[model samples]
Target: MPVIVLEAKDFTSPLFLMRTCAVLSSCTAFSLVASQQSVLEPESNTFRVFCMFTWCFFFILTLLIHILSIIQFHSLIPISWKNLVITVAVLGGLMSFSASVLFPWNVMDRQKVTPRCVAAAVASCLTVLAYASESCVLCIQPHEQRGYMGSTPGLLKILQLWGGCQMIPLIVDVAHGLHGVHAWQLWASGASYSVCVLLSFVTLVVILGDLAGRCLLPFDRFLAGFSLIGVLLYMLATVICFTKILQLRNPGQSSPKIGELFIMETVVSSVTLLAYTVDLAFSIKQLCDRSHM
Candidate 1:
């Protein structure tokens, strides 16, 4: 049964449907994995641990959302209910995406893959689709009525920033391991990533928590300013990654798996750059529109 919305309207909203799907799928994933522990190899417990953590965390948080909405609980919360919902949905989707990839990759190589294990992997993927749908509907379909980071571009920027942060650890590796890269170059690369992450993360906290308008500067200009700086720093980080890091990379000599990791990091960096660039453009446009108004 659908949890009745607090409004007069019946249970017809796509958001509600997606919420239900997310909750159920999350529950199914963790439960399925937990029940069949004997089937999986002991060495492959990392996959089980990660999937269980993602599913359980999502399940608990989403269930809390449903309860909060049903009871109209709002006080003491730092962010708006919808903003919190979107944040959870997007983060949950990312975690589920990771779990889906990790779970299947671990299992597919095993000689004796069980039906139950396959079902658990499928359940993990289902959670991803469910959360992704919820994110799209919340961020795209009715974004204007939502919070600052609720719009399509804004929500996508959050994903981009998160993805970039994930890839930034590769820079840490380069900073430590690069043979020809200078010490100052290593320090600059690491500092660039640190500043970009800290700035972006704090900005997101202010915006999604509805604290942007309360700040001294105009939120639009603040966002635009932040994006501009972020683009520059992210670009600097990418340059260090591709130019300096890759110069030391010897793909022909390294194992194929190690080579693949390098390629994947570079691809993520490129995509992250494009995402931030688009955000910078969008932020500028939004600032201009606000000025005209």
Candidate 2:
């Protein structure tokens, strides 16, 4: 048979090359636009600022509440284990504020704010450590303390788990930011925040279920209701965080749409602050009730 050969000119053409390049360029442009939009959208920045401010404000409020709790409910203080838990919780709150402030800068331009990021990372580590230590203390209180039984054990364990879960996102965020892993940090932060929210809801359900089984009195019901409010508020915050994550992932789709997510986040944080306040109030009431007995 006769040999037939194909020339390069038959397959290669200027028009074909041009079209391919155009398509690739379009995709690249779209990706860049999307990335820029995600980071620069007014709504996103606004929400970020709002969350930072809110966390800082609540951080101070929590400190004040803890101080008052210490003063007013001195008799209720657990000398050994509970004191450790309170210390962890207080320290965690302080670190949370520092993290919130440093997070925005870390995300915006980590190189310029490396020192701040490092500080934030240290604070986050301390927060996680404190919470984890508190959890351990609560879990092992029975072995170390004399009056560690009944509802106290159960309550301590539940709170320990709750605190531990809350620390997950903070740890993830800190780890990523400190290493300059922006993409991973954002994803991890979102996951951790979501987990905290889910855990909080689960905690609320468990608390209510336990109360239902043991307490039927009106006062007990009131306490349960107050706790439920706190849970609901926290749940709302989780939803807001979820929305923010989604917007961040799909940037440049629409600014108005993304704005809604930011707004939701702000609203949820506000609600969470209120819920925490109410929870503290209920704690005081419980302390009073115990005193009467």
Candidate 3:
């Protein structure tokens, strides 16, 4: 008789423990929110709702992933399991950040902080930490040992996606004040945000689903071109945003929040622009490397 040694990737390994933690914390945090929902203010519910959505969505996703992994379901699919794992880890971390931070803020950032809110906050924070730990474990491994999405360019794509998501909401908020207020410039900025977010999202999906090479266009070249476009659009948007914000500050604007929102948009757009630019540079280098090969 031969004795079998379980691999680290086995369903009974530490990774499963991580997923189990994620599932439990998500459920606890969600239940706490629901338990006291009637007592919370309506205005606060918006943030709480977002928090609930995050918990419910990610919780289900975590369970499904674990179940699938246990049944060897990933083998039935074409997607690279490690690549999918790391990608999910990264995304879950980002999504859970809102649930952890903003949800707690919604519950506790008030004059009266209840015990239910405290418990929920603690659980949500633990949920975020679990996701973060999962991401870190995958990220800290040797470069050659991981999937493409676990690489530098792929991580940048995640940041770009997150930045884009954050901006779209703020842009809509800022647009509310635009009676004719910086109309064309705002439109230009908004367009940049919308388009970049869409492209970045599509790029990530193609890479994760392993469809990049199957597409009609050359993947690297298309990515390089799109990254260049993202850089330009963000540059335009950032410059306009900052210029308008400066204009607002020096002479004052209609509302402080309008200026505040633009300030946030400007910061995120700048960071996203930098990420895209670096990704573009890397893409160009990759193309050159491929050509040489």
Query: What are the clash counts of all predictions, listed in order?
Result: 0, 0, 0
TM-score for model 3?
0.82
Candidates arranged by lDDT, highest first: 3, 1, 2
lDDT of each: 0.70, 0.42, 0.77
- Give the better candidate number (1 or 3) by lDDT: 3
At residue 279, candidate 3 shows an lDDT of 95
Q: Which portions of model 1 show Cα errors greater than 4 Å?
A: 1-13, 31-53, 75-78, 110-116, 140-144, 168-193, 243-253, 289-293
- Which lDDT tens digits does candidate 3 get at residues 93-116? 877775676555445655558788
Per-residue alpha-carbon lDDT of candidate 1 for residues 41-142, written as tens digits (9 for 90 to 100): 564464556668878999999888867776566544767666777888887888788778767666665655787778878888888898899888776646
Please, what are the lDDT tens digits per residue for candidate 2 over residues 1-293? 43343346633543223323322332332233233323433323443343344344434533443444334443343333333334334334333433444344435442433344344334434434443443344445454442221134234333433343334434343343232224543454455445545644554444433333454555444444545554554455455455555655564533543344344334434444444555545556776788799
**Candidate 3: clashing residue pairs, number:** 0
Sort by TM-score, top down from the best:
3, 1, 2
Best by TM-score: 3
